[model samples]
Target: MTQQTFIITGAFLGMLAIILGAFGAHALKKLLSVEQLKSFETGVKYQMYHAIVLLLLGFNYTFSTSTMYWCFTIGILLFSFSIYGLVISDAKGKKLKVLGPITPIGGLLFVIGWANIIINAL
Candidate 1:
């Protein structure tokens, strides 16, 4: 993706993270348990973290960014979205067993992304 696309995506994801965090804090608190809320917060945290990373990647174009961008994008989708799904489903007494493994894979992608950046830097 282009730099502009990465920036826009980052901004959009950041907005989403803020909205979701607020929704969890205000609306979901009444319905979700403490553990579920924590899970949701984890999703929000990682989303925001990667969103900032993406924004940085967009702003600084010195190193390779495509791999990092894709990694962040896919990682956020898999990790955050899966957690959201898991927490939401669990709150409703449903379990998404399949998504359990996907979160770590997303995390691995994030690690790979960061590692790639460091490697490129050196």
Candidate 2:
């Protein structure tokens, strides 16, 4: 995807994260268990983190491209979205199971993205 596309996606994702965060705090609290609430927080945290990275990529358009952008985008979507979905599932009385390994992959991508940026900068 182009820089603009990913950047906009990130912005919208950021807004969603904020809305979800408020929802979790005010609304979901009474409905959700403590563990589920923590899961939601994880989602929001990752979303906000990647949102900042996306904005930075946009600003550093000249250098932020290729693998780093790809890693960041994928990591944001899978990591953040999974957390959101898991929380929602739990809230709806659905069984939330950690069947596959996702967090580690997401973290790896995040690290790679940042490393790529730093390496490119040097």
Candidate 3:
């Protein structure tokens, strides 16, 4: 996707993160245990962090949008979505295994994107 489109999506993601944070602090805390609340907060934290990263990637025109944007997108989807699935997996009474593995892969993508930034700086 184009940088502009990625940025717009990042804006939406940022909004979602804020909403999720509020939800976590209020509704989720009441409904979930302390550990689950922490888990949920983790989701919001990663989502918010990568949301900013995506927004920066979108705004930085000198960077290759395709690489940075795609990495950010995939990182958000995998890292955030996995936590969502793990947290709510009881809704369907199913256990998810891939989430643990995939979350780190998403983290690795973030690392790579930052590595690229370092390379550009050099």
Candidate 4:
């Protein structure tokens, strides 16, 4: 994606992260178990973290390649979205075992993206 696109996406995701975090803290606190709430918070944290990464990458523009951009974008989608789905599903007494495997794949992509950033910096 283009730098402008990344920036826009980052801003949107950052906004969403804040919304989700607040929702979890206020609305979900009573509905979910402690463990589930923790899981939800994890999702919010990682989403915000990568949202910042996307913003930084967008602003830097020339420092990283499309591969780095895509890794973080796709990683956030897979990792954070899967966690959100899983937590909600669990709260609803449903199991989404399929999404469990995807979270690690997303994490791997994040690692790759961070590695790429480090390499580019050097």
Model 4 misplaced regions, further than 4 Å: none
Report model 3's TM-score to 2 decimal places: 0.84
Once model 3 is optimally superposed onto the true structure by TM-score, how far is the C-alpha of residue 18 displaced, in angstroms? Answer: 1.3
Q: In candidate 3, which residue ranges exceed 4 Å CA deviation?
A: 90-94
User: Which whole-number lDDT from 0 to 100 does residue 91 have in model 3?
Assistant: 34
| Per-candidate RMSD, Å | 0.9, 2.0, 2.1, 0.9
Candidate 4 local lDDT, 61-100, one digit each (tens): 9886888888988999999999999998889899698999
Instruction: Score residue 77 of candidate 2 by CA lDDT.
Output: 74
TM per candidate: 0.96, 0.84, 0.84, 0.96
Per-residue accuracy of model 2 over 1-122 as CA lDDT, tens digit each: 57786678678878888998998899999988899899889978887888878877876678777687779878877777777777777789784657126766777888988889888989
Residue pair clashes in candidate 4: none
lDDT of 3 at 102: 86
Give one digit per residue, the lDDT tens place, for model 1 in 47-73: 999999999888886664789999999
Model 2 earns a TM-score of 0.84
Q: Give the better candidate number (1 or 2) by lDDT.
A: 1
Q: How far is candidate 4 from the true structure (C-alpha RMSD, Å)?
A: 0.9
- Candidate 3 overall Cα lDDT vs. reference? 0.78
